[model samples]
Target: MSNHEGTKGNLLAFLPLIVFVVLFIGSGMLTNDFSTMPLNVAILIASAIALLMNRKETFSKKVDVFTKSAGHPNIILMAVIFILAGAFAGVAKGMGAVESTVNLGLSLLPANLLMVGLFVIGCFISISMGTSMGTIVALAPIGVGIAGQTEIPVALAMATIVGGAMFGDNLSMISDTTIAAVRTQHTKMKDKFKVNFLIVLPAALITLVILGVLTRGNAVELAGDYPYDWVKILPYLGVLVAALAGTHVLVVLVGGTIFAGVIGLLDGSYQMSSLLQATAEGIMTMEDLAIVSILIGGIIGIIQYNGGIDYLLRMITRNIKSKKGAEFGIAGLVSAADIATANNTIAIIITGPLAKSIADEYGVDPRKSASLLDTFAGCWQGILPYGAQLLAAAGLAAISPVSIMLYSFYPVLMGICCVIAILIGYPKFKRTDDASASISK
Candidate 1:
């Protein structure tokens, strides 16, 4: 294809992404019920519009493009993962996993240490599960409940959850963002983890200490009514163990669901029909996220077709001159895409290839580049009030997403650490001779 044709194609690919943001984010702002405006409807509309925008293609060809993008293996895989996650979360809750886990956590910690403990738990769960959304879903309600009893600011409580969730999301080896970053950058999961851990570990520790200090004097009486402690905590443990074993997210979730079902049945808390009902409810609960994911996927596909990503890449990399500039370029590439898409994984996916190219051109290490993509995209996603993590955290805590942003210390710290790493070149890798030759050439 001619350069012009290629550019046009890329531009066409990005149109759906623009529409999704405008519709979903804009409508959420206007309506004040982020949950009320269905994300799938927005995606369906954007997909249709994308299909229509292919003026030169035959109807069948347009259908083919839509199918190709929508049914891409990655998209299908994510959908499957989503289903399993939903089912697992639902079943686990029904089986009393959330409450059990909460009780277990509460049982172990002194009241003055509750806030830091929740943050630490949130981090551990997210890191193990590789999903901040899952962590928030499992813990935010508990955090809220704690708040009601402890007189803690709901925003602070929610922020604790959010901070911990982001910590895991940024560092988890099994996380989708981690997977995407590793695959895109052509780096080993272990290598990426090594670099990412160094950057985020300090931030997490500092945040924990700060939280401990802040909540040291706010002890409250613990509630004591729930009795499913051991069994309830089992589901979360099952999921976490499966995830840490490198089981596929779907399998891990299925394992969690089965565990929840069996435990619930043995305990007589739920019948067979109730298990099914819980599964259905879990699936139903993902309605908004499902819609948002589909729409974001289709929109991003359209944006890719339109060369919008390329345009941004060219614009951002136009003036790269130094290591710091190259790092800034990497950060900007992912951050801009994230801002446009409101999905960190998608942003990394879109920017990965170009980022690789930029890294090669500017003599940046692939490991560093990979870390930058995940870190910066995560930073933006964690802070965005409208993004999924914050939204879920906010929704579960019954607080404004904006409020959570103000207290999101970990994400902010991660960003600062990334910048410092780039400037000081800590954890630097020796570049391959061939890569060095390419950069010089």
Candidate 2:
């Protein structure tokens, strides 16, 4: 095909994504009920539109593209994680892990310390697991339950969980964002972690202090009969320990499910079929997310084939002239990709190479560049209503995603920190020396 024809073809491929956003976002606005327009239905319509748009290809070839995108190993792996997460969450709740954990927390913590405690736990779990999604999934239900006991707003509690989750997601060595950043920038994971930790730790500490002071005067009555002992909380501890050890998330979740099941069974709280039923119910709960995942994969695949991403990169970076400009460009690139794709890991993968190029040309540190990619994409993902984290939190809390955004202190702070890092060069490196060393090989 001619170059012009190739460009045109690629542009045509992006129409489906446009359709998806307009249909999903518009329908939600028009109906004034975001849940009224199901995510899966929107994805189905977009995927079908994409399939039809590729009319020039043979039917078999079109099927191959859709199937390949839908069944990509990463996509499949994520689907499996969703399924297992659902099961684990259901079983854990069925066994009273969430109730016990919440009761235990409320018993131990003063009312004023609740939000801070939630934030601290979120950071610990995400740091151990190296994935925000896992941390959010494991903790959100508990957060919701705690909200009911304390009369705390569910959105506020959920925001605390999200903030802590992002804290770990940005700094954890095993996280996909961290791995992608380090690998793309050719930096050691430990080195990048050090830099990331320094930049964001202060913000987290400040947020904790703020939350502590805000809740100091507010106290809630605790139920006398609530389970506040240490033993009933073992399942959460087990999940945290396994995740920190770099166990695969699926494995961590499966282990958690087994532990919860055993605890429930031993306690005579549930029968075997009830346990099985909990697993099935949990898996079924994520049906919307699973469908959204496959549909998004297919739609994005078509967009990639059409050169939409290339166009975006070119358009955004057209004005870069200095290290600071380059840094902002990198942030904008990934943020835009995230807005388009509604997936942070995918955003990083798409923008990483291009970000590397920009960094190399402008003598930006790979470590810093990597940090920017992960941080900004995560920041955007945290606030986006359609993004998995927000959606999952919303689903669990039964609140609007916009309400969650109002209290998402971490992402806002992180974004400010990222921009400040660029301006002040907090993690300053010998750029020329680093560049020479990198080019030497």
Q: Give the per-residue lDDT of model 2 (tens digit) for 105-172.
A: 88788888999999999998898788888888889888988888876789888988999998999888
Residue range with the least summed lDDT across 10 consecutive positions in model 2: 432-441
The runs of at least 3 residues in candidate 1 whose Cα sits more than 4 Å from the true structure, single-residue gaps closed, are 1-4, 8-19, 22-63, 128-162, 172-194, 213-219, 223-228, 341-346, 384-407, 423-441
Top-TM-score candidate index: 2
- Cα error of candidate 1 at position 167, Å: 2.7
Predictions: Cα RMSD each:
4.8, 3.7
State the lDDT at 352 in candidate 1.
91
Q: What is the C-alpha lDDT of each candidate?
A: 0.74, 0.80
Q: Output the TM-score of candidate 2.
A: 0.89
lDDT of 1 by residue, 1-441 (tens): 122345423544566656755776678788876555555676677777777775655767656555666566665655555556567777876776767666665677787788888898888888887887667766665687667667678888888888888888888888989999888888777777778888777788888888888787787666775344776777777766766666666677677788889989999989999989999987766555545555555545555554566677777888898877888899998998887667788889888988888887887777778999999999999888657677666544555566677788888888888888777776756556543221210
lDDT of 1 at 84: 61
Best candidate according to lDDT: 2
